[model samples]
Target: MSINDIIAEKRKNVEEIETKIAQLNRKLSFSTLSEEKKKIMEEITKLEKQKRESEYELQKLQNERLNELAEQLRKRREQEKQEERLSTVLPPVEEFTLRVCFKCTEKTNCEAFLTKNRQKMLPCILSELLNH
Candidate 1:
């Protein structure tokens, strides 16, 4: 059951105990009064104990749910931080460098093109990757 439902049930039990105690107090007389009072007190104690147990269980369940949500939030934040770090600190493709032929496409030397146009092509390649 939900925490609120458990708490409401606990409150109901307490109210019942209080009603019983009040009734017992009203019915108290000289004959057998002590025995009846003791019995009613015992019943109240048991009900109170049950109420405490229910409250404890409710708290435990709430804490478990809170912890699970907290863990999920923490993991999501950590993942976002890792992504941010990667985006800011690392290039899109580490194994490849930007090399484009400015003169002609046929029989172009990629290494010669990269060495000559590295400064100009770097920003264009990074922007394309970012947009993609």
Candidate 2:
């Protein structure tokens, strides 16, 4: 079962145990026999322990869910940061095409020319050529 399902089940168990304990306490108050009162008290104590264990499991599952969400958020933020860096480094394809391909003598074979002469400083070279 999923963690959420398990957590819900645990919460239900705790609620049921609490209800049973409340009923047993009511019984204990009404009963006059010492043995019956003692038995009811014992059952209440056992149910309370079960309730505590169920609550602990529910808390653990919630913490795990929170951790998983935090990890996903961190990865998404890292990917966005990487994309931002790349955006700053590389001109958009449309901008490159407008500034270089539209004006090049090799317009008919610009794709081939660009592939063969690809360089880190291609924008700078294009700017110098355009200036002259």
- How much lDDT does each candidate structure score? 0.61, 0.78
Q: Across residues 1-132, which tens digit of lDDT does each residue of candidate 1 receive?
A: 866676566567656766765665565543376787787667657756765776676567667768878999999999999999987775554333432233333324555354655555465456645655
lDDT at 60, model 2: 91
- Cα error of candidate 1 at position 103, Å: 12
The digit string of per-residue lDDT tens for model 2 on 1-132 reads: 988888888888889998899899889999999999989988988888888888998899999989999999999999999999988876665575556654565664676346644463366447746686
Candidate of highest lDDT = 2
How does model 2 score by TM-score? 0.74
Cα displacement (angstroms), candidate 2, residue 52, comes to 1.0
Backbone clash pairs for candidate 2 read none
